[model samples]
Target: MSNNHLTREELQDYVQHVFGASYLITQSARIHGGAQKVIYKIDCTNGFTCMLYVWDISSNYFQEEILNEPTFHSSYGSELFSLNTRFLAQHGIRTPILYDLNNDRDRHSYDFALVEYVDGQKAEAYFQHKNHKDRDELFQRIRDMLSNMHGIQRNVYGNANDNSKKAGPCYQVQRLDAETALSYASKHMKDIRKNDKRLLEKLCELEAAIQPRDLYNFIHGELGPDHIWIDHAMQPCLIDIEGAGFFDLEHEHSFLEFRFGDFYHYLKNNDLDPERMTFYRFCHHLSLISGGLKLLHRQFPDQQFARGLAEYHARCVVQMLS
Candidate 1:
């Protein structure tokens, strides 16, 4: 929206007047991604450049103007972002550092936080541009990063559940049963219907017969190339922890495998066998497709998102049934 508006002197003055005189915003750089929140690139604290994440007020948001929670989800997202930075930093993981956080309910009802800007391009783009010739290094780095992240996740505040001990052939089956894919795919052709029923029944049977193990940790639920950023040095740093949550350790590597293949270029470099990699990839796609279906199925949900999910489900069913 009016990219010029972000750099306007008057608006900058208002923000400065409100945030106090400790730091000067040299320039305001707006990030794309409408609604939900407004993000900006600002110079903040101790001569370092950082970003400001802020919430935007919508006419119908905040629970129909009556039942909004005490704190906005963006507020929740930013605060959690700060904690995420803390967790990663404590473990020597390379990430954009958090400088400060502010939650203000005044004037349009907004919340904001400041964080260091990790200079780089999205990992997906970066890898392709470099031709990903160093495939082995990239795979090792990814594996090590997720493993380190999970090792620390073992100590976070929200990782309370233990679904690992139940890990068996049936665990995947049980998860597939709880998925919304059944309804979406069932309305399709003979092959899809047959596959869906067989999959669900197998999952239920697996859950009962398989004795699972506890693979505990808070996983970066959205583990994909898009959420990763590779710095000028070509090192990987994870981002977009909005979907982060406690999950099966097996699920930690799901997103990556879903978008890429199970016998992925990265895993092959790391020597992860095709059979094991396929399982990881399956669980990853299943969980995500499940979540997407649930959100899309919400009563009177976002039509745009629903249509997107519909296309995605069509692809997923084809992939699964095949």
Candidate 2:
């Protein structure tokens, strides 16, 4: 085990506290790909398995100076996770059941949660080898989930934990406004702009064409096959749902299209704001470029992958400008 991660004895203590003293930890392994938190899979002597999520500064890979920036949609902390979990469960969306948590510093130095260990493969991995029929069935269910999720509209925009209620019902908000997005993205677009001197102008032109809307639909903020799990029963379970909230449906669709690529058609909706789509499409790539660079600069464990992402999005941004 790494020095930053919990030791075997600590794991045993946590498992014993939650699953009863009779349950003993058989083994524990770290799950990769989480840049914000450390996740581990724990197997117990009683044949029980669960996931441990640890939120500490050591596990985070992003630049800490801007972690609290309002433009960042991802929420943290144990309370937000619990809130999002209940929010999804109330909507009949499938998600991991949170078993227990220790947010108080007494039990652990940092907040952590134990959730039901889903015995399944990632939807992204599952898609690679599945037959066409199986793929269709899976995509159909995913489309249904999208419909059910987007159908949930809130009077105001933002996450359920947001404290902007004083704005009252009928208040509308964008996940990231154009001005703020441009301000943040422009700083990172210098190299990209050099490729096309008028890049910023073109982006501004696209931004001006965006249409406005008042209704806010529930969105996963960051949804993709990787964040989805296919359990033993072949049902889809949404993971990393802390970013789920009420925002522009287009924001969610933009991410789905980017992540799912060619297969996105299966989940695409006929009615979407074309102008908003155009604008958000740029925002999406810009965010990735900034995020990827941030990760690389912060010396993320997967530096090569982060650099690849940054390069990929950088190319996409230049091409879009053209």
Question: Considering every candidate listed, which one attains the maximal lDDT?
Answer: 2
User: For residues 1-322, what per-residue lDDT tens digits would candidate 1 score against the true structure?
Assistant: 1233233564455446655666565666777632235667766444656676664443122222124422111213455666666666676676776656566555435556666688887766644555546745765786678667766544222322323433333235425433444544455434446577665654444345434444346567556676777777768887766445554555445456555554345632343334433444444444435444444454323656644654564466457544
- Per-residue C-alpha lDDT of model 2 across residues 130-222, encoded as one tens digit per residue: 488887888788788879989998656878766364353221123243334445545665766465435557666776676655677988887
Superposed Cα deviation of residue 225, candidate 2 (Å): 1.5
- Evaluated against the true structure, the overall lDDT of model 1 is 0.52
The C-alpha stretches of model 2 lying farther than 4 A from their native spots are 1-5, 63-68, 163-190, 193-197
Off by over 4 Å in 1: 1-29, 33-38, 43-49, 55-76, 130-139, 153-157, 160-210, 262-313
Per-model lDDT: 0.52, 0.74
For model 2, what is the C-alpha lDDT against the true structure?
Answer: 0.74
